[model samples]
Target: MPAVLGIEVKLDPKWSIVSTPLFEAYWFTDGLNSGRRDELYSVDVGLRYSFASNLSLTNTVLYEGRTSNVAIRHYRDLRIGPRLDFAF
Candidate 1:
């Protein structure tokens, strides 16, 4: 099963904030990993500024982590980046 929550808030007209949080579960049924279950969690948050209706920039941070019944399958990561969007 997977679940997600997303939100966006407009501050005035040119700036906004966006966030999404997600959770997912995976089960493996046929392999050496049979009857194994893993849970993944992640979230992304961004601050966006619009220069025009067709152009925008966003700075974002993301974090992800996973837990598994198998010890070698657990991991965590953090990422930050900028995104430019244009519609032409």
Candidate 2:
């Protein structure tokens, strides 16, 4: 099963904050890892500024991690960047 939670809050007319969190589970049914389960978690949070109705910029922070019964599958990562979005 996979699940997600998201929220957005407007801070005045041109600025906003947004976040999305997610979780997923994976089951291995065959091979050497049979009957093993892995869990994944991730989230993205951003501050967005709108220049116009069709254009916006967002600075975001992202984190992703995974855990499994197998030690080799455990890992985590963090990322930060700016994203530009436009619609026509």
Which structure among the candidates has the greatest TM-score? 1
Clashing pairs in 2: none
| Number of clashing pairs per prediction, in order | 0, 0
TM-scores, in order shown? 0.83, 0.82
lDDT measured at residue 37 in model 1 versus the true structure, 0 to 100: 98
Q: Give per-residue CA lDDT, model 2, range 1-88, as digits (tens).
A: 8999988899999999989899999999999889889999999999999999999999999999999998989999999999999999
lDDT of each: 0.95, 0.96
Error of 1 at 56 (Å): 2.9
For candidate 1, the TM-score is 0.83
Model 1 local distance difference test score = 0.95
